[model samples]
Target: MIVFQQRYPVAFTIAACLVCGSAVAQSAIEHHVWQDKRKFEPYSRTAKSITGAIRLSGNPDFATPGSKMTMTFGNGKKVGLTSVGASWRQWDETDDKKATAEAFKLSRDPGHLRNGNTLCGDPQSDPAQYVVFLERSTFGDSTRLLGMAVFGSKEVPHDINSQSLCGTFSYSTD
Candidate 1:
């Protein structure tokens, strides 16, 4: 007959193995978004006011996290060739989470290229930064986002930041 001196160790080992197995079995799916193209006539008075609409889609695998995910812009066409004043917000699924900061700038050159950085609060409430790239397609009348990549930390602070892409943005000059 086999005798067991301690059952607690055996039970703990079994529980640990089950937890680790469940974690290994669960794989995270990549999320994505594509904004519908729209036309924007350059604002005329040093900064012309333009208006347009865009369709935002979430990747099939992930759910749209919230209703308030959006982007906003401030003053533009400043300092000869820079759009200096721009601010955007990316909302999360919960109100307890603060919106991600979308601070970006655009080149005044003919291409009107865009480059910027965004920061989001992590689960630990630390700020994580991401690089953004945007450009207007010369072949088409629409604008395209080249890409955005987040780095510097293994763990993303915000849940929305974990998605392949957080939000699709549409803009107008006002």
Candidate 2:
């Protein structure tokens, strides 16, 4: 009976290893350069663009905050983005489940005053706030929406803090 029990555990261990190995083999990694556009209202202040790069891993999960990212513009300008917040949305046949990985406010040294309050909504909400969406793609890397709202302390007429898609993007596992 002792020998049978020992063999059973060994078999279980082998089976577990095989399952985990298969999952790792099926997973993949990719990077994407994305272009986004944002248009504001009233005065028709239109067409602001930003180019960004994202590195994505398989299993359709969202990336964690502080996962190094960079953005470039049309005139050969570039900036590194420090991800302050991230939320993952899992889609089923009927509904979606959202999970927040990090919750914090973003503040640029010069302040992002292009399209006020367009990307991220009210900042007063507890646990922070995020908008997540899943886009159709042949590549495993999906589209993620991120933003925040900045209230002017005393000066400025509450300009919207935002970034939009612009320029070409490439995807690769390497």
Candidate 3:
């Protein structure tokens, strides 16, 4: 899995600057950069663990049954997503079955929202969100949505950020 911080070092900095304003983002960048000159990794805590089905927003073809998506996130402040086209068939049925079962079980929980997690609804409290796009869509050459998930507090963490916030995400295309 591609670690978001390692892959896109400046992505969050730019995004933070755009959403929260240059002052806040710059301050954060400066603080983090000052702390660690090698890289700017913002620390955050796992306030909640939310899991549910997520759609690839505007890309339907990549979200189809035969397509594949693998997501991974860790202490860093971003979600790592890797997608495979529909034609590339080499998926593990066992993993899919487990993920499907978990999704079903979570669906019965009342705490979760109707559409799974409420990351999009509350971005201020938890700013660490992730959106993925297929570099090459199955139907065309342009980038397309793969999927996305969010779960983390914006407040700086006093301890090590080693916990998994949102647990695991699962869904079925059938």
Native-to-model Cα distance after best TM-score fit, residue 118 in candidate 2, in Å: 12
Is candidate 1 or 3 superior in TM-score? Answer: 1
lDDT of model 3, residue 48: 26
- Listed in order, each prediction's TM-score against the native is 0.22, 0.29, 0.21
**Highest lDDT scorer:** 2
Clashes by residue pair, model 1: 43-48, 44-48, 122-157, 123-157
lDDT digits (tens) for residues 1-174 of candidate 1: 123325466777787799999988966653223222222233222113221122222113222222112222222212111111212233332223343222222121111212332223231333333222222122254543322222224333233354433232323322
Off by over 4 Å in 3: 1-54, 58-112, 115-117, 120-122, 131-164
Sorted on TM-score, best first, the list reads 2, 1, 3
After superposition, which runs of candidate 1 have C-alpha atoms over 4 Å from their true positions?
1-10, 18-49, 54-97, 109-174
Clash pairs, candidate 3, are none
| Winner by lDDT between candidate 3 and candidate 1 | 1
lDDT of each: 0.29, 0.30, 0.27
Comparing 1 with 2 on lDDT, the higher-scoring candidate is 2
User: Where does model 2 exceed 4 Å of error?
Assistant: 1-3, 6-64, 90-135, 138-174
lDDT of 2 by residue, 25-90 (tens): 854553211212221111111213222222222212234455433333223333344444343433
